[model samples]
Every structure is written in structure tokens, then in C-alpha cells.
Target: MSTYNNQETQEIPLVKKFPKLKVLPHVNLINSPTPVEKMMRSSEILGGMNIWIKRDDLTNSKYGGNKLRKYEFVFPHIQKKNKKRILTVGGLGTNHGLANVIIANDFGIKTSLFLVDQPLTHHVRENLLCDYYYGADLNYSKDTKGAVYHILKDLVTDWSSYYLCVGASNSVGTIGFINAGLELAEQIKKGDIPEPDKIFIAVGSMGTVLGLFIGLELAGLKTKIMGISVLDENLNSTKKLQKLIRKTMNRLRKIDKSIPDVSKKLFERFSMNRSFFGGEYGRYTYEGLEAIEIARNDGIELDPVYTGKTFSALVDFCRNNPNAKNETILYWHSKSSVDLSSIYNNVNYKDLPKEFHQFFDGTVEIDDKAVHCIRKKKN
Candidate 1:
């Protein structure tokens, strides 16, 4: 493994700590120990609590986000199995698909994206163009089930291909966040940030938060995790997350037979907040836009769909719990901070796939029911 900042190649501490766990050979895909900086201005604005931000946004220069952490574990497993192509699924504007294509290209691995329709936003269009520009074979399906069928067919016909699910949420991919939890523990020991009383993270596919919960358990940190759901509100359950975490722990147990069993006590370490989802997954909210404006004051960029909603929750928590001013709070900033306007500027949307051109041309209108609770009133 390696990090861009220090240029050091060392075994990840998680593997060193639990030698019995089986791990694939790793390649350094990110700059390790992404800075843990205190949100001094936001802290002052939000009732004087000790607020901090973990900048997963700067995971890399071109592509960065919480997804890169998962790719660290996922790409290696693909290589070890000698897979020539990676087949994955997501919505038309998925950051996961874009991130997968960008990083997989570094290792000379081909990626195929099977996607369904999503609301048209600049972010979604940029991702679609980049997916093509980055040389991913693209397949647009009517819905998710169609995409799944296509992936299964590809796996059977093209034996060299591997079908990794959306956001790489499986057990193996979840290891990256386990490493992240340990990384934070080291930063705390070094006094980069105070031991947080609560940690806030956006939850979509659930691997990121699930891994962090498991990692904190392994690292022996008692910080409570506040997983803000970016998808369905019903997913904010200990029951749902525990299923994924148990599967991940079972995978780790393959390396050592003596790992602790799952219990209700372990589940108590995390809580879910689902009030910020707005409406459907891709819809922007009134509060989410306000959050972007607030973070901009602090010189932090938050995209409307994910991190904005997550931060809104963090902000709301502070407002509602005015008495908890002295407690430390951490927000895991998972969205990419890098700007892609240059890449978006160079590409003509009409040159891309025919089905995607409608999004740019304005012929295919967005469904009115798709968006909700915006401050801007639509006629």
C-alpha cells in the first residue's frame, strides 16, 4: 500500500492488527490520512460545539469521495481473481459508476456500466459523459431489474467479467471503511481532532457507515455514528445495517475463527436519521440547498444530493440540542470537492449516447412528482 502525501508503502494497520483475516494484495488508490480539520467557523456558527470535518472529499485529484475507500479493497480482489472486466450497476448519474471507471482505468481494467434513468442534473450529465470519456462500455436499461439481467448474462457469457453491485456495498468492498475507522483512531491519538461525541455520515448503499461502525468497534472507539439516509427513509434501521455488517464480519472471520459474534450491544453504537432525504433519492431539498450555502461560508463545497442533506442533519442536530454545545461532533464529508467543469466544458452532450441526449436537449421533461419540499416554488 502507498499514500500520495508521504509516498510510504506499508501494510494497512487493520491487516497487521488482525493477522488471521484474509486480505487480497492492495494497491494505493488514495492519499492516506485525508486531513481531519476542525470546522472552526461552522463550529462557532453552530452553538460553539467542537465541530470537525473528515475530508474524504479530497481522496484524489480527479475523482474523490467515500466510494474510493471501497475501491481500495474491491479493485485488488478483482485483480487477484484475474478478472478482465468489471461489470457494475447504478443510476444514470451515479458517482459510484464514475469513480469505478476512473480508478479501474489506472489498473488497465475494463468497466461496463448498466444504468437506469435518473433525474437530469449537471452532476448526473457530467458523470454520464465522463463514463464514456473514461472508456466504460455503457448499457442503458429501462429499469434496475433489466440492468441486473444484463449483468448476469454478461457474467455467464464472458467468463472473464465480474459483477460488482452498486456502490461496491458487498463484504469485500466494505473493508476500505474499516481502514478509514482505524485511520481516524490514529488521527485522534495524534491530537488532530478531539474524540467526537457523535459522527455524522450519509448513508446510501450502506457499506460506508457499516464499515465505519465495524472499524470503530475494532479500534475500541465509543463515538456514536449518525447515519443520515440519502436513499429510502426506511433503511435507517439497525436491523437493515446489521444484516450487511454481519455478512462483512463473517467474511472477516474467514481469516480468523475467533471473531466476536453479533449482538444487540454492538448495534447500540450507531443511530439512523432519515428526516433529510427530501423526497426521492435524486431530488434536491430546501434544507439541502441552505446547507450548501452555509458550508460555502466556511469555504467547503457540498453537492446537493448527498453531502448537503447529511450536513443539514448535522446542522439540525446542533439547533435542536442547544444544551449539548460543549460536546464534540464530526461530519464525514463524503462528496468529492474537486470541480469537473473543465471536463464537462470540453464534451458536447450530443456526441454521447443517443438516449442520454434528451437530458441535455430538454425534450425529456423531469416528472413533477420526482422533486419535493423546495423553497423555490414551481408553477
Candidate 2:
């Protein structure tokens, strides 16, 4: 297998020296060279075509996930703008918000989060408590997705600090995954990974998928990338992804007017298949639960909200696509370890619904040695 360095050297231009590239200063938050592991069991289960995983979950940084990669391209702009605080919008258990809080703290930037009261699983407790422990100013509203725009608009009146949009929807944030696509392409050329027929990833806000689309086009790779939607909005995720791609391409065109207009073709080249969303946002299905168990048994971790559904879709797709059986597939596992200590402090366990009681029942015990009055529940 071939290896490539994922480090961003100082010699590299602030915005990557591409003539059409829009440069933005961003703090480096994720560790470089996350390992790519081939999934043997998953491959066998799907009749063995070669299934692989990109271990973004193992990113050496304390806050790991696909978000950190996006932040690498975001935080620098935040720093350059001299923004003291970041305001973002997400649901109650927002992995994006949690990652922002951790990275912002590292850079000494305060963060305010607007959390919508969306329907979520009772047992899941990853993003909410992490946000609290990281000391993000939290606000809650039962705002539908449309209301989020107005909420942010209203917030600007109350607070003058710059707002960090979730997924960093602009060109700056998209660069992170564009760079990842470049890195993945180089790996393929070096024979580190077999040429994948398909790549599956979860799509929430569209930055990562758009970045991947741009990067693959730039790298001239033919792999088909699919985005599984976790939210149940009627709008197509591909359309949202295309909009971001157009915005990035437009920004690039401004930097170097000489670049060809490939925006229309780029949209056609990047395909997003979203037949996996069962129903509603933040809700789990039986397939998702089965995928979660299979993943855990395979020694990989996934949450039901995002990666679980994406991986489940990938498995089902592989099983259904008879023509694709001969080619390799890739599933992007994009979750990180939960910090139980901080979760205990922020979430009231008693408030959880009874159906989810088993998840936190004896699994999370308070440490008597830590001097906090928190006590472990007797099993």
C-alpha cells in the first residue's frame, strides 16, 4: 500500500496556490494521515468485493470526526477575521456543534450554539453534553429549518460577533474535504487502496460532500461518491450539494478568471443517491440498528444518527448492485469517542426516557476518586 503525508506545510499557500482557489486562513485541528483500513468482515458479508473504511474517527486530535477536517479550513478564517466568538446552529445532539466547541476552546474563541428541538433518540447523548462542558453559550428554540435563518438574523441584532455556519457552507470550509479528495486520489494512484467503484458518506449540511466532489473532479478520479441523507427534508441533498459546489467554483473563478467554466459539468459528474433515509430526521430504523451492531462487532464504532444510517445504506446498496460486486467499495466512518465524564456533568440522567434507561443505567458510573459529588449507580 502507498502512503501520503496529510500535513499542511507552512510553505503551502494560505489558500493553496491554485489560481482559482479562494484562500482562507484556518487553524489546524485534525491530525494528519488518518489510517485507511480495509473491512474484511463487511466485504465477506457482502460477498467480498473489497470494502474499506477511512478512519477519520481515529484522527489523533482530541476532537475527531469529519468536522475537524472541515474546521482545518474554517478556524483560520475565524482567526484572521479576529472573531472573538462563533455562533452556529444545529440540533440538540449536534456533532458539528460539539466539534466547534472543542476546536474553538483550543483557539481561545468563545462559541454560542442555537439548538433546535428536533426529534432524536432517547438513549443517544453525544453532542448535547459535550457542548455544555466545552462551555458554549446554548440557546434552544423549536425552530424548523426555515426558521433557523431568521433565528440567526435575529441573533445578529443581539450579538455583533461573526457567525460560523454549520458545515461551513462556503468555499473556505469546502476546501478541507477537497484536500481530502486530493489525498485519497493520490493514495489510489499509489495502489494504497483499490480503485473504489463507490464511496458512501453521511450528508447533513453538504460541505464535506461538495468538497469531495470538487476534489475528485480536480484529481480526475472516476469513483462515484454517494451521500446518505440523515434528515428527511423534501429537497434533494444533491441539489444542496450542487449549490455549494457552484458557490465554491464561483469563488475560484473570481480568483482566476482564466479558469474554464466547468460548474455545469461538475454538477453532472458528482452524483448523490439518497434512497436510504427511511423517514423523518434524527430517527433510527431497524436497518440502522442492525448496521450499528454489525459495525460494533467489526470493531468499528458508529452512531445511529449519522454514520450508522450511511453505512447501512452502503451495505444494502452493495447487496443490491449486482454489477458492482466486482469492484471495491468505501464507507467513510465519521464518528468519535464520547467523553463520558463531561456528559455526566451536563446531562441529567434521570431526565432520559425509560426506553433509553439501559444505555446509561450502569454503563456510566461516577468516579468517587474525582472529588465531584457525582456517585455511581449501583448495578
Candidate 3:
């Protein structure tokens, strides 16, 4: 395996020795101790070194996924500010928006979602149905994904309440990953798995990657994190991330107020290396479909939008990189198989494409009584 370069090692100092920063209170929304499993078959297929999968999909939440980890760091801030309504942005069929609504409902907080149309599957009706079930207020936009930000900006002007960005692309929200890094460090020390040479994950708004990178530095775990950009990698995305990271570092500095000049280098080390986004945001390639099928056959669930793109990139990276044979790679599994009964009870199955119906073969059916039981636990 490739060793950590001196420059990278020098970037992150000890957490305790670093500046102290006051972090915002965030509610716990995810189940801890997510499994890190070895991917022997996948590794063999790629002809690379040891490969592993971090099963974040198994996170103990009603709608489980990597987004739950981030929500844990955001919800408390929402409550603290006494925000009555939560406003979020994403494409139709957004796992992020779906997750946000569930958490908001559990907390007795009303939510409003702005849905945009993307090139991929626009499951607007399905998402709208779920939002209605969860009691989330909904808004639709025919504008591009980039224009949704302005739409949100206009809505926030009349209402004096806290707005939780979809990815929680702020400093407080990013600290969730710092906490995750600490948890991961403990797992490594406990021999849960060997120190991974590289970690691969999906990046949309860049909150998760930024958090993971900062958390790795804080927890003193030396690992390379590769972010597969699910969004378009352009100046706009880059600028947005730069602003957020800077804001995060500044917030951290304020928490401690005693640390030296570490923010700039820390921000640099946490920089995202986005080399694998296929084309525009939300568009999937044929290779992504193949990767999704592969994981599905392995009894792992992956969505076409994010996880599929990330897995495809991991496969290509392993095959092309000469040093991959000597390194250990970890793929973050970040989607939960959707429960169709809640969504399709009154709809005709004939409306779905043949390929889409295949997803229903082994999915668990939860009736109204079952749904009541599930909702009761959250209450």
C-alpha cells in the first residue's frame, strides 16, 4: 500500500492540539456502528488489492442512507433556532429530501421542499406522494438545478425562519463527519478493519466530503478520500464548496479562539479532488447501470444517481491505477432499497417499466398497520 506522503501528513495536526471550536448542537439521526465489510468478489472483479464496503446504507433510521449522518448535525440547530418550517432543495426523487421529511416529521417540524427536474428519472409524482404522506409542503420548479438556489433565496425573504440546506452545506453540518472520523478511528484501533489506503464516496454539494476530510485530519487517520462528483464539476460548485469550507474553518477557529494559523492549510488539505463526474449533474451513463446491477446481485442496494456513479468510478480507478494492486480501497454504500408498498399501493403496476418492476421482487411489503408501528417508534 502507498504510504502517506510527508506533505499530506503535515497538513493535519493533532485535534486536541489544534484550535478549539464551538460546534452547534445537532440531533442524533443515524444508528452508529455501521458495518465495514470486505468485498472479496468485487475486489476480484476489479483485479486490485483488498476492497471493502462501508455499509452506511444499514444506518438505523426509517429512511437510512449517508444523508442521515449529516442530518444528525443539522436538526439540533434547526430546533435551537425555533424554526417552525424547514426549507430544502433537491431534484425530484431526492433521497436527501425524502430523508429530511422523515426526520422533520419525527421532530414535529413542518417542512417545505423545492423540487427541480433533472435529466435522470424524474419520479416527481412518487416523491410528491411521499411528501404528502409525511405532511411536507411541496413546491415544484421547472428551472435548472442551479436556479433553485435563487428560488429558495426568494422564499426565505418573507419568512423569518431557519433554512436547512439539503446537504447542510455549512460548518456545523460538516462537523458530523468530524464525529464520524472519530468513530472510524476508534473502529480502526479496535481492529474492525485495517487502515484503509483510500476511501471513496459520492459528492453532490460537497458537505459530506468536506466533513470526512476534516474529520480524518481531526481524528488523525491518514487516508486518501476520493469524491465522485454526482453534480456538475464547474466553477459554480467549486465556488460554493470553497465558501462553505472557509466558513466552516472560521467557525472552528471561533470555537477554540486559541489555535494558530491552521485554517488555511486545513482547508487546503480538505480540498475535493473531483475527477470522475460523468457529464452534467443527475445524468447516468451505461456503466453506472452495470455497476448498479452488479451491486444488486451482490445483495447490496445502490441508487442510479449517486452510489452507482461512485461505484463505477471506483471500478475504473482500480483498473487504471498501477498502484491500486498494492492499496486498500473502501466504497461507501449510501442508499437504502426503497419500500414500494408505501409508494405504489393504489397505482397500477402496468405503469412501471419492465426494468423498474424488477426492483420489487424481494422488497418487503409494509401495510398500513406496519406503517403505524414504524411511525409509533419515532413518536
Candidate 4:
């Protein structure tokens, strides 16, 4: 609920360098400089390691999540161009897709999503219903080629539409997370939390970690970043992040050519851990569920898809590395903290696209882990 104070906000060099980033059209969706708090209970249970959480979950009450941070930047860019429609892509239960639908509605811009298949868990079912409730146009794609074709066709035919890369991972959206890094830097300065020895975050499309890496490095913090890959193991999270970082740097350079160039040394500070993936993207893992339960002890609600798996990695890392007991660790809570039961309850499944109704009707069989958690909650 607190906006970042002037001193801390002013200290962000990226904001200073790209003055337009401040003046540009933007919707104030997130309650910026979201509070940083120590996870006292979780820390105690884990044997006294300093652990903390950056509550990006409480970014906004209406539809809070890390994607809103990206939209804070992307939405304005689209507005400046006078675009009326946004075309984006993601999976069936994409946090980004639902976020885009909700936030874009604020600006009167319609959202069209090209979603690929994923395990039909309750989360996926809920998002599909909410997407329609929020007035998004949806097209289900069977494969990557189909998704690409949908995007290309939209671009070719729709002059009023703007394409947002999956999860809005473009340079513009990535800037939001860079700002997040600055916000964290300011928090560290104010003694809200110590400069973490390592930061654990879920990495799906690479924007969140990429921005944190750039922001933390620019802020003169050498904290190592551990990204838990929630996507497929076959996907190269590190290489994908490197490419995004390079692209983001190129974008920044264009804004202020005098900005210093990034070097290979920065890459050394980052490493990806894939042990928690638990197979494909949407399926749940047992450790993720356990991590969710563990976090719940401290009153944190972590979704099984992303934050749960990332925290599971955090848990495993702490347990395995006994030396890390005293080292400061931070978990970036990326999932939306707000409960969606009320919204989902009110949605009429029949109103959703017919294809998506199968998820709610039990016609689609998916991995049991995600379903187990959902059913357990209901029972």
C-alpha cells in the first residue's frame, strides 16, 4: 500500500537516464516499492538462515502478480502509439494472459490471446474463465507453429493491434523489472532487508530475473541470482536470459548511449537450477506442494505453478547447503497473492469458449499432482 518514497525513487539511475520512462504514458497499476519483509517463521524452521520475501504479490488488489509490473511499462507504450488492441501468447493457465486481459481493460484496449496447451489443472480452468470474464478474445493453438501463425496473421491483418511477446518479455516490459531491481536496492538502503546473498525467483520467460540481474548489478550489489525454471527442462533458461539481457541492454543503449556496456562478468553472477521443474510447465510437483504448505505456515499463498516450485528449490537449496544457514536468502514471490475464488465462482463456464469448457467438465484428463492440490483444497 506504500508508494516508494522520493529519495529512493530518485536514486534509481535508470529512471534518471531514461527520463521518458517517467514522463511516458502509464497506468499506475502496482503499488510500487512493495514492502520487503523477513520470513521469520520459515527462517526459524530452516535453522536460522536469514530469509526474506519481496511482496510483489500485493502489487495490486484487483489483479496483482509480476506480470502487472511488465504491463506498467508495456501498456503505456501501447497507449502512446494509440493502439486499441493487444495480441499476446501464453499457455492455457498463463498468469500473463489473465493479467493482460484485466489490466488492458482499464485502458479500453482489447486483449487477444493465443494460448498453447498445458495440463488442465484448476488454475488453468480458472484463468480460462477469467480471461473471458475480463473480455479477452481467445484462440487455442495446438502447437508452437500454430501459435506463431496466429500472431503473424494478427499482425498482418490488424493495423490497430500491437503484439506483446509471451509474458511481455520484450525490452519495454523488461524495464519494469529493472525498476523492480531499483526498488529493491532502495529497500536495502533503508534497512528494510539486508542485501541478500542470493535471490530465488521463478524464471518462465526470463523478464523478471533479467531485470533483477541488470538492476542489482547496476545498483552495485553482487548478490547471486538463482532462477528456478518452471518451464520445460529442454528450454535453455540461461541462454534465453542472456539473449534477453543483451536485447534489453541494446534498448537501454539507444535511450542513453553514454550508459556503460554490460560485460561477461555480469553473467557469472547468475545460475539456473532446474531440479524443481517436475516435468512439463503446467504439471505440479510434490516438492512444490510441500513448499506451498511450508510457506502457508508463514501465511504466504504460493500457487503450484510458479512460486511454489521456485520456493521448493529455495527449500532444497537451504536444506542441502548447510553452510547457507547463516547466509541471507530472498525469495521473490511472483504469484498473485489475491484469492480468485469469488471471481471464478461467479463466472459462467458456458460463457467461456466452448473448447475451454472441457477443463471444467472433466473431459480433459491432466497430471494428477495439480488436480490433487485443487481437490484437497475443495475437500
Show where candidate 2 strays beyond 4 Å.
1-23, 122-124, 145-155, 158-160, 234-239, 256-261, 338-379
- Model 3 residue 126 CA deviation in Å: 3.6
Tens-digit per-residue lDDT, 38-68, candidate 4: 8988988888878899999999888887998
Error of model 1, residue 230, in angstroms: 1.0
Against the true structure, candidate 3 reaches a TM-score of: 0.78
Residue 187, candidate 2: C-alpha displacement in angstroms: 1.6
| Order of candidate numbers by TM-score, starting with the best | 1, 4, 2, 3
User: Cα-based RMSD of the predictions, in order?
Assistant: 3.6, 9.2, 11.4, 4.9
Model 4, position 98, has a per-residue lDDT of 92
Show model 1 residue runs off by greater than 4 Å.
1-10, 233-240, 262-266, 366-379
Each candidate's clash count: 0, 4, 5, 0
Query: Which whole-number lDDT from 0 to 100 does residue 177 have in model 4?
Result: 87
Residue 50, model 2, lDDT: 76
What does candidate 2's lDDT look like per residue over 181-283, in tens digits? 7767767877888877788998878787777777777777788888787665554355665677778778667777755455666646555544555555566
Which tens-of-lDDT digit does each residue in 137-216 have in candidate 3?
A: 66655454644665567566846446667666667777666666666766788998888888888888777877777677
Model 4, C-alpha of 82: deviation from truth (Å): 2.1
Give me the runs in candidate 4 sitting further than 4 Å from their true place. Answer: 1-13, 16-27, 233-237, 370-379
Candidate 3: how many backbone clashes? Answer: 5
Ranking, lDDT, top scorer first? 4, 1, 2, 3
